[model samples]
Target: MSTATPAHSSAQSGTAAIQSATIETRDWLIAAAAAIVALIALYAVFMDNGSLISATGDYLHEFAHDGRHLFGAPCH
Candidate 1:
């Protein structure tokens, strides 16, 4: 009185596997950290005006300034 096939069992198992899949906390933490780093890099490249790295002298400022000009960002 059983009509279950091998293909039907495999399909059920695949659905179960998909339903069991979960995004762990570590994955979320890594994503958050990456976003933070990207934000910091963007800030350093575009918005930094010696206020962020003032103690390091104008080296970083000039570097970012030149980078801006290279990208045609109009810094002056």
Candidate 2:
């Protein structure tokens, strides 16, 4: 025998709890910008070979070198 229950139970028998949240257009834009920045950073960390930000010299390469090797990317 088994009993079934909703994941979230409320004081009201038939109604699930509702939590109200709002995100403005500005907030969405900011979040999108942040996501893009994060993706760019990830690409720089993993796929960049001193071309995207070559002004930084080999700093980025050396910084993420161990990470590349750890992820089994052939740096040689």
Candidate 3:
């Protein structure tokens, strides 16, 4: 007698099984560090107002003036 299995017993194609993903502490730390750096850059670009990096006259101000208007942050 033949011992072949039925066609319905085969695995499905194209679709993958679900998985449970977890974030470790190191991953969170890296993400937080990147976020902090991005925030500092954003501050320098939009809300600097020549307070933190404006020691050399209006260089920073002038440099980011067009950017301020483009972002609608109001530098005037």
lDDT of each: 0.76, 0.72, 0.69
Residue 24 displacement in candidate 3 (angstroms) = 1.6
Model 1 regions lying over 4 Å from their true place: 1-23
Worst 10 residues of 1 by lDDT: 17-26
lDDT tens readout by residue for model 2, 1-76: 1233443343443342222123355678899999999999988887788788769877787899999889876674
Per-residue lDDT of candidate 3, residues 1-76 (tens digit): 1344433333322122211123355678899999999998887787786776547456666799998999898788
Model 1 residue 54 CA deviation (Å) reads: 2.5
Candidate No. with top lDDT:
1
Off by over 4 Å in 2: 1-23
Q: Evaluated with TM-score, which candidate comes out highest?
A: 3
* Selected candidate, larger TM-score, 1 vs 3: 3
**Residue pairs with backbone atoms closer than 3 Å in model 2 (clashes):** none
* Candidate 3 total steric clashes: 0
Instruction: Flag clash pairs in model 1.
Output: none
TM-score of candidate 1 relative to the true fold: 0.57
Clashing pairs in model 3?
none
Q: Candidate 1, overall lDDT?
A: 0.76
Q: Write the per-residue lDDT of candidate 1 for residues 8-76, one digit (tens) a residue.
A: 888998987776664455677899999999998887787677777669565566788878888766575
- Which model, 2 or 3, shows the larger TM-score? 3
- Write down the TM-score for model 3: 0.60
